[model samples]
Target: MMKKNYITAFDGLRAVGVLAVIAYHLYPQTVQGGYLGVVLFFVLSGYLITDLLSREYRKNQTIDLKGFYLRRFKRLMPLLVTVFLVTSLYLTAFQPNMLNQMRMSFVSALLSFYNWWQIAKGGSYFANLMAEAPFKHVYSLAIEAQFYMIWPVILLLAFKLIKRRSLLIFSLLLISILSGLEMALLYQPGQDPTRVYYGTDTRLFSLLIGASAALAFPSQDQRLAKLVRARQKGLNRLFLLAMLLMLASLIYLSGQSDVIYRGGMFSFSLLSALLIVLSTQANLYLTRFLSNPLFRYLGERSYGLYLWQMPVFTLFELKFPGATGSWLVLLELILLLGLTEIFYRLVEKPARSVKWQSFKEKGRVFFATPATIGKAVGISSFYTLAFIGIFAMIGIFQAPDLSYAQETIAAQLSQNQTKEKLGQASMSQETIETLSQQYEVSSQVFVQEEPIAIVGDSMIAMTYDHLRQAFPTAYIDGIIGRSGEHGVPMLEETLAQIPDAKKVVISLGINTDGPVILNRNTIDQMMSVLADKEVYWMTINLSQSQYTWTDQVNAELQAASQTYDNFHLIDWYQATIGQESAYLAEDMTHPNQAGQVLYTKMILEALAQ
Candidate 1:
């Protein structure tokens, strides 16, 4: 008895919402309010599912509990399992450090418990690593599933107890009020609101709003339908205006503030409900635009696209670190869409169709599909228990690998000593002044003989210690300091300290956010200062790990390298990208000791010519 027309515009809206979220993840600055897409999705889900359930109740006068759950499992589990298995295989092949986290996340995602797991782990959905995880999108699915489990039972019980329409409305009103209050209190300042975002209590109102809208069915009067039809165009315009306003507000507010409140949540939920109502009512222009075939296609495959895009994005970034810029970012976006489309067609779509159809026929709703569910559950449980047992065994029964432990301790101690030495040797005011004077005098005396005077940012400083070791007898002075201090001003400071210095070596480009625009004006000024001196500019090293912005950085650096003659591009990135274990530190930012050594050797080899 569910009206097919009611579901028409929902798919198109969903397509737009999913696209928005994907674009935001791939190119955040361009689609700053993309996160709101998830909230919109939640609203749409509540409205549609509630309507479906209500229709069933009206038709049969009793809910088919098994069918309700079976349908959900069919709709969701196929794609979920496909994504989980693909990601697991990818990790097992290429990434081992991720094994533990991936397994836990996969288990949580499979069980529709990721939201709670995220809360328990205090995980940030927006953090760099979190964004890369394949299972992160499952959080919203988890929230929706939790509602599905509880709402039907409550409605069934309430229907049995109360025949009065007013009582049903009153009960829904009470639930909404309580949910709103809980959201507000949980979101108050200084309160740990992790549960509010993850819990059933604070999120139930969104579902209730949908149910309320469904209960208010369209009147049968022809005059009322005509009135609604006549006003549809105006309401459609209003919905469009509201969407634009909401998007702009999110972008502006994201740039200005960090605080999130339940009022904000309520406002967003209201806007979503309005949009859903307008779309479902077939408000002329909105429905037409949202229901376009292209959007519908994207909508049909949206879940698959969402599942596949993040891990692929991470892989792309890894393959082309330091290559992020406007154009490269655009390319990444296109590639994501193309790749996701292929995945949907070839893998996810086929798998889901097969599994879902089978499950529908069987009328069984296991955690996953019954064919693979037992194997999945068994494997997942075994791994979980095995990991725990292994960890405990290591802690309790097994002795340490003495040689390996000793070597690690020794290496750490050596690093500590070196850091202490560097700390003590850092120049005081008087020493810096004396060195400055000496550098000035020596620049004049040894201008022709001094092979190199390194200058730039932390990248230069990081290589300095090793470079000194490489050329102990050569006069190679480095005038580099901390990260984030590289610019024209810092260059001027270095030149001031060494007035007669020649043969400047520039090593910069890390920590830069946008396109690496090497100021031609600054290079021109330096050329004027060191008239005939040979200038060797090393290209920025590839990042130890990939980031969303890495492609932009690489593209800019490559462009800049092509522009300057004296700027010799070393292409160190070719060897380093995706080799995170070979270079990255615990923070995943700076290079570790082994990385420092490896990079220094590469630079020396590059300069040997």
Candidate 2:
């Protein structure tokens, strides 16, 4: 195996892949095809690793397994660990909700088993939520490492078993076909293909394709080299066309669907291989263009850029969630590249050069030797035993009084049933009689009369039980609807369902700015439906998490309330302004149980008047 010089077009392809992934992360819908970068990485890894192994075999008549692992460990571990540590620190300080996930991600990443861990969790590499895992980028590294672990032994065996290159090709094809069939079979419908996408078995085909390319064109033969050079101009144009196709496919497919291979990966990998082959020849225009100092610089730092980009982007989004417009996104991209370059120089480059003398060198131990072999088997056995033991304990503990425990939980939940009936009694006698005639009155309905209709999103949904308690006989019909669209459309929809409904209570604005004006068309429509009915327009609750727009919107809503005679604007803003603890959920959006009770009480008081 001869050492072929670095191909400039390949470096250019690497740059293309890196940029696509970055753009996709910055603006997901716009750059959906960016996911193909992973496939591109797989193919590139396959080609490079195969070439390295071939070179080692030719030079020393054997693969330097120890040196290979050492180089890989040294190259990948420092940057990965640094990112993981940073993510851990961030989660510890800011995102307590994601701490569990961060811990699991860190452990999986440290072990170079993130691919398997992600698969087990049923999460995609490109999923929006994966930003929580700072080291999710390492799934590719895990796949590559798993491949390396198996490839050396397989290559050694192949060297002994096969004389003809055709035999090696046949073996590769057989493995690829079998692995692909398994991948297809394992793919679950409707579930995210995170497992299939990251699994070593499924992704092996990409690597094998690269290996095939290596085998098919060993060292550049003189006739082939001349032929490639002679057709460089036409080939360069074709390469340019292919690159365009790759970009177009990425953008178009991402917008259309999330099916990874169909959208971008398949086309990108094939095109990348062709570009790699063409770049082997000297004086090629495509090669010259790709070999530019800037493109090469980006390609060199691509790994670091990929590692740091997501965490940086996530923090940016957290700080300025409203800066989601195209120009701002572009600014983030520029900032990411600049920051990545700095990190590469200051952190990654320095870490790579620093040797870990603490790592004790162990000489080549046979894969089948008792100590090495037993360690793998023992670890596997221990895990299997541990899983069974945990499950067995759970089964035994649950087996005795599972039904009783369920009943206990059910009984506890039913405790509120009594309170809800008391709240329903707060409704007027006329409204209670009307509701009882329409729907089956539950035994929980207390013998009091009240009339109110509560409506909003999930915030209102959680509060329904407590609301029923506050106004026992109040004809409380809480309908969950989105904010901004809340006022008239929701009221009309609920009124139409219960035509004889008297009092309409609005409790929305969690998902939208409170000051935003009600849709006039919807308002007119509601006024038309409820021409003679009394409507109590509840003022939007002031969240402790105040935004400038929200303040403005609340003021506008307050002004609108004065225009309608039937609408009695209850100023919840004044009452609940500083009382965040009353309404805010852990996510700081929905009202908790206590908040629901407070809100229900306010609405009941207005209806009572």
The Cα error of candidate 2 at residue 316, in Å, is 0.5
Local error of candidate 2 at residue 370 (angstroms): 42
Best candidate according to TM-score: 2
Residue 56's lDDT in candidate 2 = 71
Give all candidates' CA lDDT scores.
0.56, 0.58
User: How much is 288 displaced in model 1, in angstroms?
Assistant: 1.7
**Could you tell me the C-alpha RMSD of candidate 1 in Å?**
11.7
Candidate 2: Cα lDDT at 227:
73
Writing each residue's lDDT as its tens digit, candidate 1 over 1-107 gives 01344455677778877877776666555566666677777777777776677667777887888778867776777666655565555555555333445555656
lDDT of 2 by residue, 64-144 (tens): 888777777767776676565555455445643434345456557767788886665444443222223345667888888
Candidate 1 segments exceeding 4 Å error? 1-6, 129-132, 166-170, 177-181, 188-200, 217-226, 247-262, 325-327, 342-609
Q: Model 2: how far is 606 from its true place, Å?
A: 20
Predicted structure with the largest lDDT when compared to the true one: 2
